[model samples]
Target: MTGYLPVVGAAMSITEYDQHRDWILEKQRDLELQDFITADVLNGNWEHLAEEVLAKLDGYTGRLGIHGPFWNLDISAADPEIRQIVQKRLDQGLDVCRKLKATHMVVHSPYTTWDQHNLDQYDQGHSFKLQCIQENLGAVVAKAEDIGCTLMIENIEDVDPSIRVELVKSFNSNAIAVSLDTGHAYYAHGSTGAPPVDYYVKAAGPLLQHVHLQDADGYADRHWAIGDGTLQWPALFNALQKYTNHPRLILELANNANLPKSMRYLSEQGLAQ
Candidate 1:
């Protein structure tokens, strides 16, 4: 179903995904991958490359997830006009996905405005920020629904997870859900005192549609392969197993020679073959 965590994966480019096509297919069969994301293919040739790669990974059967444009993609602009501009990036991303026949698209929430101090700027009457987010998001959701694609909104560290929940609640659409980023949750826990989890994923478990899993150093947002870092793999896996959310799991590991070892290490941590 849509909820089975896939442990599907990615690479630096289409050429890399093609190079590992056999491996990806073999692993998909072995692991029963339900969904996965491709690495950033921002040069606009993503459509052509994705088509070729999917044809090669024919043995693989699963859902596909795509990460929308990330560099300076201000989906949460404070300005209404600029917010409209940012929304176009997400639209373009889905246009690419529609061409590739993808089902779910992961997008980021708007960032809170911070001065040089990076303090709580929300109290500075920043509720309008959420309005901008909603306006852009509503538009994207309309497009996604037209194509029968789901928009999975990922959580950011600075924004309270509760806020994310509220945002979803505000829109109240079936076409929208949450994409919990594990590494981001870990990085959000800084010396400045952040809650363990915004409970965004756990709270919105039912609507939790996608996952991006990776191990991190508990400080930097290093997307290390599983087991190469400090995250408690067994515990996390166990929690996931019991989760009613049943979000699709994408291994979402770093692309490097270290991948083989990392994959094996995770299999030992409750992800049985």
Candidate 2:
């Protein structure tokens, strides 16, 4: 919405998109599709479904992003066989990106407090897990490079930004970067000792490529509209302006009904156009 960066909306499914398409078209906001492509992968027709979705969006001129298939697919799985499945899912996501000509794809991080608890399970559990992630994503990064799509690794259960930032830098590829989820950061801060939202912006800095902008009560990932929860919106915006202006800020609201309200909040606050 601003000259410095793009502000977008999130759609969890095609049905949700259809329900909110009028508002989205009216605003001409870009979108991040969460479960839309994932459902196609599960239903065994993502290729065809991707073409259908692309055709539907042909008249709607805006950038596109996809939240890849990350549910239960751990790229850093200890088992080699399981890791292969993870790689396959990511490859499928890349193929879908190629078809849709999506600008970004968000992948979930496998790190959690559980890794710290199971430290002795490996030589150095944290480092080993990071290595596993690097290896798995390294394979997919090549496809990402070939397709000219940027892969964003998002924080889910991370207690801090260090691990995710380290993972992104280790790739050292423009094709890969970091995706920060606001609600997840608050949830981690409340439950697992992660820092506040501004800390993530400062920590990620330039590597931060995309964001899932949702509000929460600091206990659960509520995914409410931007101003409806405990997050400090003004401070977060200032921190982002100081740290970087490159990340795409996406409003990932749970209920489609709240999308318009959330957009109005961003515009009224002068954070977006």
Top model number, TM-score: 2
RMSD of each: 4.7, 2.6
Sliding window of 10 residues with minimal summed lDDT for model 2: 1-10
Residue 150 C-alpha lDDT in model 2: 91
Q: What is the TM-score of each candidate against the true structure?
A: 0.80, 0.90
List where candidate 2 sits over 4 angstroms from the true fold. 1-6, 35-43, 116-123
Top-scoring candidate (lDDT): 2
Backbone clash pairs for candidate 1 read 5-249, 6-34, 6-249
Off-target runs (Cα >4 Å) in candidate 1 are: 1-12, 27-47, 112-126, 197-200
As a TM-score, model 2 comes out at 0.90
lDDT of every model, 2 decimals: 0.62, 0.80
Tens digits of per-residue lDDT, candidate 1, 178-260, equal 77777776777542234554344555556666767777866867889877778655555555665665566665666646557
Lowest lDDT 10-residue stretch of candidate 1: 29-38
Model 2 lDDT, residue 221, Cα: 90
